[model samples]
Target: MDQYKLFLQRMGLIGTSTFLVTITGIMLLPILTQNLSIQDYGVWTQFQITITIIPAIAILGLPYTMVRFLSASKSRTEIQEAFYSILFTVIFASIMGAVALYILVVPISHVLFNGNVGVGLILPLTVIMSALQLVFVDYFRASNQMTKYAVFTTLQAYMVVIFALLLVLMGRGVVGAVTGILITQTLISLIMFTFVLKQIGFKIPRFHNLRQYLTFGLPTIPSNASFWVLDASDRYIIGIVLGITSVSYYSAGYTISSLLTILTSPIYTVLLPILSQFYAERKIRETRFLLNYAIKLYLIVAVPAVIGLSILARPLLYILSTPTLANQGYLITPILATGGLFFGLYCIITQIIVMERKTKITGNIWAISAILNIILDVTFGYFLGIIGIAIITLLLYLTAFLITVYYSLNYIRCDFYVKFAKKTIYAAFFMALSLILLNPYGPVNIVLSGLFSFALYIFVLWLLKGIKTDEIKFFTGMIKESLVNVYCALRGL
Candidate 1:
């Protein structure tokens, strides 16, 4: 198959998986919030933040390195050496990371976990399993094994939800939920390892290209850490300055707004490997086309999503969480959703930078942004509460996006789709207007209004000729092809 078709199919697979994973995550929100005390819920949120940051550091950015370096690899031996080297290195780093985390548990417990020692104790185990899981998942991603990638990704998410829900329901509270996650991560990591071993067999990894891998990957550690700072440090600041209860509120709203990021997930997952391969083959035209097309596709959905999410934030949060959480946190959705939009754009634009192998530039941009974010997070969070932190988040994301665009263009110029975006904005504005006029309330009404608003947005965009006929046909064809592939796979099973 052509790369475009394969990209679409892989995208469809990953997109569907991401949507299911997101839905399951959202389903857990009410379960956790209602079952645990507000303080415990805050601790649960903090646990999540800690796990995310730890794995980003512990994995040492090698997953990204694997994707960049191994995406174009055709030699089984070469793949084996690179994969095992990275995996072994990640294991060592994760062990050291866990030990560090264990040593610092007291401070972390006080600062982030609201002084919950039990949760702090369990974190190192979770981080180690999570770090290993990261390497396993990325191996499939780098190999373009999207079916395996999507299945395992979806399975891991569902398993976490299932285990956490069961444990939380069994009256285990925060620690139980954390334990459940660790169990899921361990199981998934082992299962993935088995599959990888069966495919590539084991090798003692000569570390032939280890230095080159680390060279590309290590810079990303700072970038990934900085991203976590941008993406999550506000929770820490909120927990510290405002209190754990306020962290719960901020996290709740942030979670709802983060649904906007699901639109970017498949693109982020699929684009990198494909672009890496294309660029490696020196297919510059295809590379540029993919990048430009990705941004356009992202904005088409993302623009309307930002507007729709912002408009429906209150009702969505109310339905998903408690009234108190909804009322206190709903305002955060618009700001964060807007930030998510910019962040999504930044993700797409940075592919060019990645293609050019200027990861240090990307790292530097985020490093500066993260520092500014931390400073602003403290200042605004201390003075103005979670709302101030949310505003700062939006500004920093916008700054990152602008800087990335400016730098990325020096490598390869991309169409920003200005006119197309203007049309999408118009459609989204009308969608927002329709929702406002309808004034959707309650679960059933919100569901209905959301559907109507989306349809209206499409209709308006269609009338504006923003969606061309060929584009519609192209998507229709992609969907039909995806369904046929699913049907064939099911029959084979």
Candidate 2:
């Protein structure tokens, strides 16, 4: 029971922080679209995709090892050694990555932007800052410092919004936006590094079990890179095949679809450390229960959310971006939203692999999926335009989830509640029906209709007894606890 309460508290903090990030991202869509031309936005989108993959490659997969190893450590000295080892390793890699970025800037720019190499000058700095930021943020998460993690993440999001918007408004275009990211990450990285140093102190990393860390973390580079291929390669394909303007349209729809992750991501953040701890302690029953509950909770929210996004994709695109984006890219949301749902499920299921120390299996799974995703994305894009690439994403995740689930079951058993899922599906169908009957126009109507649809879904679920009383009590407790925490913080202020 205490464990459950702690989980909820952690969830509330991380969830609130993730929610803030989603809001900032949503806000940035219109600001960026209005400020930069579609072509420029496409270039920015391409740059964003590069950053996602490059830093993962640069870090040599050590951050994930932090989550695995650091979470399991007992002694403060052991924790410090593991933390600083990963930190020093990532720092070295960041310097190497910056140098590589500088050396390859012209070629990369030519490939991604058709020889528009002006952004190359700052790409190295962005890459370095991003790599360090990734390590710092992951360290906090591994240490179970949820409040510090939330504060740093939320600060970075707000800073990016404020600075990026100002730069764009001042006519810096894509360069301004990239600069905003660079500056914000640099500042936040310094702050987080200081915090981590204070916590871990300035001892040599001792290089204890360094080979174990490498053996565990190294294989994940391909896995992470492949997952990136699954997630972001489509934009590159779109940019290459259809041109930058289409990339912007596709990116707008992709961003809207990513809203689904806001629901799952925070839970994912909390789940990793908890699962790691539970597994390490041989608490198999507890681990199984948490896994089942997470799956159910994700479906209960994700099913309706996916349906609703599909229903309101166009209106959302229109309100959040230009009419051009709405008209050209609205269809991309339903596909990607559904894909996002599968991806979230995969995250939950794949924890079995992580818990079992079958990290290499993860690498193999994503490597296979990545190859298939690239093949499908490229072939589909050639034949079917932007929608083809979008469909590829959904298909890729569905495939990955099935494969991961099949392999994961070998390590640990997880339940899937068919009757409960059927109930959720029925309720979601009715929610979609309600929204269709209303067929809301404009942002205000759409927002209201969504709320009505959600309330109706819950009411239907209650009527069907799909939602248990204990679950209600759990959520109520979470709300009450969060409120008390907020009040105390205000009093402190």
Candidate 3:
């Protein structure tokens, strides 16, 4: 029961945070669709990628390493020291990056964006603001306060959307939308810095241990860069090889898929700390147990989620996007969802590798998968278009996930792995087949078919002795808890 509570807290806290962030972005999606041209949105996406990839480089992947230490260490001062060290590193790195950007944003933007140099400036500011936001978020999680973390996360995204809408309505154009993002992030960072200072009870950082942060964080740089490549390299390619319209279409697909990770990411956020502590304590059995259980739980929830989105892809796109994006968006949702499942698994396993102190393994896997993705995207996307990217992405991730799972199990031979993988395969195959059988009908009929598939899934699993009675009961309890949370969200509670 105690383990269950901890698991619930970990999942609920981060999951809820991601959920709110997704809701924030999704709510604002239609506004952007209506206001911005496909080319404009494409530029916005390129700007976003620049900001994100910049932090991965500038922060030197410290946020991820910090979480591991924060999770494992018992000393309050140690956590503080680690946090301070990383914060200092981020500060220096951001300064240097900003200078470099100021010098090159114009030329870089001109090349990638067809002589649109203003976006270069927008990208750097976004990076500074976003990097601060990232550090503060890690601060909150290190302090074990998920609620504050969620609030700041949702707040930044909401304010960005609101500012974007206001600017667009007032004829801000694409530049105006970019300004909205900048303003929103700037304000959020100020609030975050203030709160973090207060939370740790330090007026100024007292840590003399920059080496601590550097040693831990530097090794993750390769892994972090590779992940950026795996995920964003296609966007980079599309910008160079394909025109802005193609980039826009690909970005739209990436955006929809991103929703899945936005919700799933916080899982890694909380899990890292918790899992690291377990590993430090040599609680290997508990580590494997939690992972096994998490895999099963994710499938039970995620299978239905991706399928439903795929089924309603058309109407969802029509309702959410303008005529320009309606068809394109629909085609991308399911593929994104498929990619999302594999990405979620990667997130989970990467956390495991971190906990086990296998940084090189993580780095190598991401690098290889990234290279494969690039190859596949170019080779297939040339012929298949966006669908080619999705297919390639989905396949690469699947291969990476299977490799992660295999090595992770070999790292610690445990019985639960076999059991967990069996059940996961059982559920996933069952669910995938269910989606296919339900594919031929109209949307409403498909939904009904999905319902029937779900029932069939449960029945088939039970008949085959895949999941036990108590397991079913536990799942039902979780569903009820989730629904209650949903109710609270609806009532504005």
| Cα lDDT computed for each candidate against the true fold | 0.87, 0.84, 0.71
The clash count of every prediction, one per candidate, is: 0, 0, 0
lDDT by residue (1-493, candidate 1, tens digit) is 3888788888877777777788876888899989999999999988988899888988878999999988999999999999999999999999999999899999878887888899999999998999999999999999998878878887888888999999999988899999999999999999999999899999999998888888788778766675567767888888888889999899888887888867888888999999998898898899989988888889888988888888888888888899999999888889999999998888888888877878898788877887888888889889888999999989988988899899988988999989999999999989999999998889899989988998899889989998987877888787677656544543542
| lDDT-best of 1 and 2 | 1
Worst 10 residues of 1 by lDDT: 484-493
Model 2 per-residue lDDT tens digits across residues 372-442 = 87788778888998889888889878888898889999978898778988999899999999999999988
User: Taking the tens digit of each residue's C-alpha lDDT, what string does model 3 give over 1-493?
Assistant: 5865666665665576577678665566677777887777777777767777887888877877677677656676776777877887787888789888888877888766556776677777777777777888877776666666666776787788889899889987778888888999899888888877675656256656666666667777767765466667777777766677877776655555666765467666667666676778888888877776666666655655675566556655555666567667568678778878877777777777676677778677777777787788888878887777777777777777777778877676433345644555576567668667656444477557667767766766676677688877875676467546544543552
Q: All candidates' TM-scores?
A: 0.97, 0.96, 0.87
Show model 2 residue runs off by greater than 4 Å: 483-493
Ranking by TM-score: 1, 2, 3
lDDT of 3 at 9: 60
Which scores better on lDDT, 2 or 3?
2
Once fitted onto the true fold, the runs of candidate 1 whose alpha carbons sit more than 4 angstroms away are 476-493
lDDT of 1 at 397: 86
